[model samples]
Target: MPFRPPPGRAAPDPRLDPYRERAGALFDQGEQIGVVYLRIDTFWRQTGGHLWWRRWSEPSEQVQGYIEFNGGGFDDFYQDAGTMVAEIGDWGHGRFPYRGEALQVRWLDDEESRQVRVSTFGLDDLQA
Candidate 1:
């Protein structure tokens, strides 16, 4: 068996659906770069949780491999954080909060209840 999902378990992960749009500021002071921190309102369905993602630009920001968001136990699948968006050129390959799953989101317009979900990150969100 090649890891086939059982019957009735055919429902795909929902993070692909940006139920809401989240608005946050980036570290654009010129003094810093890379992901300073991210803050998502909530995606309370699949795992019943919220997002308050944050990551500081360390000195070895570029040199480090996968910047683990190590502190303590956090959310499911995303308990550890890292520079997933760093040096990704334009866009990434898979759904963020729902990696390896068939989910995609163009934008997150509703943080309370994501009204629109997409399979790709908006061009603006994936700019250099």
Candidate 2:
């Protein structure tokens, strides 16, 4: 008889839910294109975790690749010195602390009427 392998455990979802009960921005867009950044930050803050981002540059801001925001490292995912919005803004035009073009926060919802995503991007992602 052949030996059988044990079943694998289910992995937890990393994306945050930003629908219905939890939906709001913590900071204003200010004078720059801070809408997307601020929104992502707010989501992580409320959810108590981090989300993946596709870093983009200004002028011709476009998706380059995935940014590694390791969720478990920073005490406060959005407030660390290296990744803070204030510090990012200081870098001047087109310079962001993140690696990719833009930060993408993804989530899922079983509600038939609701969509499973916070941002336009990362809808197809399977992990953080």
Candidate 3:
């Protein structure tokens, strides 16, 4: 299932106008966009008798083009996040315009640090 923000957590920050504007312009151009937010947390896990760990790193300065939207499946966003992280070697942050609504990419630290969370919120739904 696609991730959903906790109740009362869906509002976009007012300071994200630049991202919103960028995504809005793409929506105006008749393009479909999907938000991709990547988070790398510091943690360790044991799987198949092997230990794996991930260390947090600073977000990259480079921003890639909008991820193409194909039905907006949960796996699609997860794959996009993985690809972006592979390219930048860090967390990914950016806005994506979807179906005429501007959705910002944001992150949450999960308890196990095992799942990637991707969500969307409209630009018009920003708080004052």
Query: Model 1, residue 24: what's the lDDT?
Result: 16
Q: Pick the candidate with the highest lDDT.
A: 3
Off-target runs (Cα >4 Å) in candidate 2 are 1-37, 40-76, 80-88, 99-128
Write model 2 residue lDDT over 1-128, tens digit each, in one string: 11222223223112222222121111222232222212221111122222442322112111112222233221112332223435334333333344433332322233321221234223332234
Residue-pair clashes per candidate: 16, 7, 0
Model 2 TM-score, all chains together: 0.18
Alpha-carbon local distance difference test for all models = 0.23, 0.26, 0.30
Worst lDDT run of 10 residues, candidate 1, spans 59-68
Write the residue-wise lDDT of candidate 3 on 80-119 in tens digits: 2223433332123334434445454443333211122212
By lDDT, rank the candidates, best first.
Answer: 3, 2, 1
lDDT of 2 at 98: 41
How accurate locally is residue 89 in candidate 2, as Cα lDDT from 0 to 100? 42
Instruction: Report lDDT (Cα) of residue 120, candidate 2.
Output: 21
Worst 10 residues of 2 by lDDT: 56-65
